[model samples]
Target: MQEYSSQAAYDRGEAVCVIGAGAAGLIAVKNLRENGFEVDCYERDTVLGGLWNPENQHSPLYPHTHLVTSRSQTEIPDFPMPDDWPDYPSAAQMLDYLKRYAAHFGLAEHIWYGSEISHIEPVEGSRFEIVVKPAAGSAARRLRYGAVIIATGHHWVPNLPSYPGQDGFRGTILHSSQLKDGSRLRGKTVLVVGGGNSGIDIACEAAVNAAECVHSVRRGYWYLPKYLGGEPADYALARLQRRPRWLRGFLTDRLLKGHRELSARMGMEAPDHKHTDEEPIRNGRYLEHVGDGSIQHRGEVTRFDGGEVAFTDGTTVRPDVVVLATGYKPKIGCCPPGLLGVDGDSPYPKLLARMFSPRVETLAVAGLVEPGVGALPIFHWQTHAIAHWLHIRKGDPERAANFRQQVVSESAQYAVDSTGVSPRHHLAVDAEEYLAGLGRIIDTLEQEPAK
Candidate 1:
């Protein structure tokens, strides 16, 4: 690879380069092609589907991983999943859906599997120079493109927490991503850490599979059941958005009152912030398991001693396996941090309207937001707007300038910092507000240019 470093980059004028062949990347390719731009999508792994595919070495999927967001809400707007599929599809089904999407849109030809964009930087103005590093031991190739969209998602890197004495603890410790099979918990006393969806789900799995299950939650979180009002919970709640604002709150409260009371009865603390502020835990069986004494819910983890874990509530548990379902950190390793408007030491990027870069006009990120809803539709609209914006920028500078202003104003209006400071809430955005912003941007991009 070093031998090829001195060679000039092969310039593909006007072609868009999409990093990662996951759902977001595939959508970007399809949208770019539809908007009459040539596209080249690169996937570091041999397979597509990103984290959805279990074969991907960095996949964060655990045993029985299913969609927290329901089918109607989760499906891509233009490419719906099968009608007969379950409301909440499994991880395997998601991979199958992504494969079908790529095939149906003829996106595979534009994809370079086993190739990664090792580095990318602005070359001439907004054009980008990218180093295409092959997974094989082949010489790395350099290419230049008109623009780049980074779809390499944030779930690959696990956010493991450190506790006192963790290094010498006698039990085995595993991040949620590493606990790929339920059999690992069988007959063992399992301690699941974190309060996110993954933690709750894995704890439920442990409740059924392990001899004992102790769940350590650091803070309170909204816990919604999988179903409400005889329909999928997310879909039902989303439908309420169409109702009058005055009626919406009342209806939402009525729907959630039972679950809220149930959580309180189980000795769980009420969430400090609104449910929309963060991704809520949506597991139906977790509370039931706790009620039945199959799962013991404990406070935050304090420390680790020889074969024992201490909690904030002064309780201690000796578990054979400790699973840390602490979620993932948002990281874009290929591109320079400053290019994504990363200031100081924060790993998360400060984007324009949560998609476009605040610094570079031609660099954008997709699927980097936690919208507390189905992210697939958000990815679809984001790529759609990005593709249209790129097309407009190439042909009409006046419209592009106006569009950029709209993005800046919208970004300012929905600035996420006002929501919270927790790293878990860093990428959080209200789904309704964000989708409306995306719709406005798309509408502006699609409008006729000055005659």
Candidate 2:
């Protein structure tokens, strides 16, 4: 790795440094600024939309990508997306929405595009010294700030899987991010791997575009249409969450009965966990493709030989191209592992309340969890709490001390404690439970300190 010399660290006293200009980072800056903090946001990409912008070289958007969650549920709380837009909007529209948000809040002036925070070090007084590396090979600059909020998000690092003889396989294999053009699948026998939203969506795409489409799944997954019960699926489900616990399950099952029966008839594995455990597959077209025999559902890929790909069930297919939609690994590369409570060799941060750093009071990570719903709203609330807490901490030491304990207790309240879950599921949170916790934390911060 090449090393660059960093200039003398310039101190921006009492200011906050926010990494990444993604939706989360933008929200963090807006909230911090609203709380009267001097916030400087850094974006590695030239644009401010983060992964939503296809122009971003590292964007994970595949062809025809759209919001898996509905517009109402996905929009930021304070700044809702256009009311005239469809229930689910396209990736381009999402980028536009984010850009609009930045413009509306005047967040662009606080953002430094083409600047990445290569590293963040804890200096004296609980402040952070951040190295800003420019994309154009300029010398790195160092700056100090009173606090830092990491909102880089976790979608950039592709979690690619290796198969036996994959190195020598003759077929072209690409991660979903690399499959930028749908024309690449045209007239080719395609295999779509993994069972996440990406995988399912790509399979449906290939079902329509490819000569033959084979979808490889490792286990059972819930296939949810974009809509259910005459409303956007996520919105409907979220509404169900407000009902009594006993009735919620019965109502949910009824709503999802058609999907479950269809998946079973198609020989799909039943998901081992509840529907809410992870973000379910949200494309309505995937199963329709399967029913029409446009998508051949197969077990996990066992090996690749010459041009033949073998599944665990011993079936083989010679695909011209393979798309691996196996999602991303949660990685915070800019900060030291210890600062985020990452155990040895683990990339995921063990955050308090899924935002605050367990080890550093002045540091927090936003939009790191998979809330199984619209993520922007969650980011809004998380950053809202963080900004409010920072404000309280600056004024009332007694209240700050009490609020820290409240956050720790709040974290435990909604934890999805279970064994044998995947690392991806580690970030999963029940959105309803988490939002309530965030609300409580905000309420605590807003309450006046005892006289």
Candidate 3:
């Protein structure tokens, strides 16, 4: 095969380019197509399910990984998951659902598998020039598109923490992604680090499989069971949003009171922030395991000594294996940070309304927010707004200008308070607030033009 010069890009006129064939990307493609735009979706992996597919090298799934958000809340609004499936579907089931979605909407043909977008730069007339690097031993291809939506997601890069003497510690250390099998934890004294959802889930896994399980955390987080009052917890909680504000709070507190007391009884520090401020840990079996002494909870790790780990509480644990479920860093390496409104040295993108780029009009990001609910429906509405925005920009200049102001005003309503939260929670948004914002944006787009 001959290599072509990187001089000219193959022009794809007015065709939208979607990066990543993940659930978000697929939804964007479908929504854009529904809005009458030609779309080309690119997936770096050979598979289309992104992190949901275990075959994807970057997948963070471990054994027995299930949806923290229940099925009714997690499914895409237009494309629901199977009715017979469990309320909390497994990772494999999620992959299957995504595949069915792509097939149902005829989105697979539009996706270019094994094609990774290496770089993107805005060219003349708000169009984008993309460098596509094939996974195979083929020459890089240059292409141009009318617009770009990045759906690459934020879970690829592991946020590993370093402790004193970590390099010299004489024990096996693995990130949650690397611990793909439960057999690795069986019969070993496991130490799970971090306090996020993955850490809690892995601790529960170790509680049942490992000889002993110890969990370490730096800060307290609100923990909620999967169900409340005999219904899915999120659904039950979300239903209160329709009630009066005063009544809603009273009802919410009543639902959460027991769980809060249980954490206190287990010697766990109460969360400093409100439950709505950050993503809460939703696990039914973790507290039970702790109660039974199958899982021991400890404070943050202070240092790593030879074959031993010391905690901030002056306790030391000698574990045969350490698992770092420290969560992931949001990364979009294909585009410039400045273009995404990233100021100074912060890695997080400061997008307008948490989706569109603050600086670039034609560049947008999808599925970047931690909505603390089923993210699939959020992506559906987000892409719906984005597609309509793009369509308005193309055909109705007057309405588009007004809609831009509306979006700016809508974004101000969601000014989040990230105080006391980790940098990883920088992208976190109140799901209720975000959905309300998305609804307003969608209504603006779908409503009839002024008479």
Candidate 4:
């Protein structure tokens, strides 16, 4: 066994350490490099696209997974996806786009694949000591950096729920990530549990491929088609935000009215929040499948009995397979929870401006928030702010102090109303409000430095 030591770390002066080589980490490296900072990004997986790459063992992608948000909104702000691609690109296309982005920015050279950041500690004067754990037989090495950015993302750890008789159930049970091949559903009675985008998409897949498909959702959610009035749904809805406040609501209602009524007519419960509050389901075929009776919409699972499953609504299903499409839990295991301001019992980090760490000056988390839109653009602006903040803090002390307060105030505007108790909702934020706050932070950083 390799002996662990607390020896002095080799310090790389003023270089930043980015955890994970996923989309967020790639963007962080590119943006930080653009800001004249040396960046070293680490990825546990061999690939660079993070969860988007199906080859990644931790990827949450299931059969036929596609982007829910339109391409125009999903692409990185500085790097746009190919215009010829479909509005809602598939998982494969998204991985390709990320690869192209890394290549275009020459970011691959800086990334250390198969290297994971096992631990991080704050050292003298805002610097960080990181332990890089190699994927193979190589001994761990310790290094020091001026700062660290946690871009590991929240989609890796699966959130598996248990029922009363789950241990005794005889049916084949699988998480969403395990059902990568659609052929797994062919000719089998499949029960897809959860109301999130993954569940709906998988249920739709099962509807066509399986002998029977039953969808179990605990609560109601806003179901949106991929398009509205001949345009992509997210694009169409986002455009309404630019309109007059009085006219916006009316226009949004008009666009969503048909889908809302259709969901109600199909016996689905009304959503507790507005369409914009949370990520609305964006698959057009899901509702049509529900309407045609191909996908049976049911209530939450209460228990499992032998080969049968019982729901809260008194309905039971005998399925050949049970697929839990419940989403992932937000986890940052490489560092201490207290460093991320995770106080007493709560798992969610209380980040300043939803990016910067409240307890550590040189630590920040990228792409941790669910901004109800294309996440890549949000990550771009987030890393942009983070890079600029680190740059400013290094030189202009007085301006950096002022900018800190400005970030706190700006972040106050995007407080999300949490209606769901699921751990998945912990990171939810209003995209419009968050983008505005990020813009303000960027403006402060971009301002002229002291004379």
Q: Residue by residue across 212-302, what tens digits does model 4's lDDT show?
A: 9999999999988999999999999999998999999899999999999999998899998878777898889988999899999999999
lDDT of 4: 0.91
TM-score of 3: 0.98
Clashing pairs in 1: none
Question: What is the lDDT for 296 in model 4?
Answer: 94
In the order shown, the candidates' Cα RMSDs to the true structure are 1.3, 1.5, 1.8, 1.3
- TM-score on alpha carbons, each prediction: 0.98, 0.97, 0.98, 0.98
Per-model clash counts, in order, read 0, 0, 0, 0
Off by over 4 Å in 4: 1-3
TM-score of 2: 0.97
| lDDT, candidate 3, 201-263, per-residue tens | 999999999999999988888989999889999889989888999999999999999999999
How high is the lDDT of residue 59 in model 2? 94
Clashing pairs in 3: none
* Model 4 steric clash pairs: none
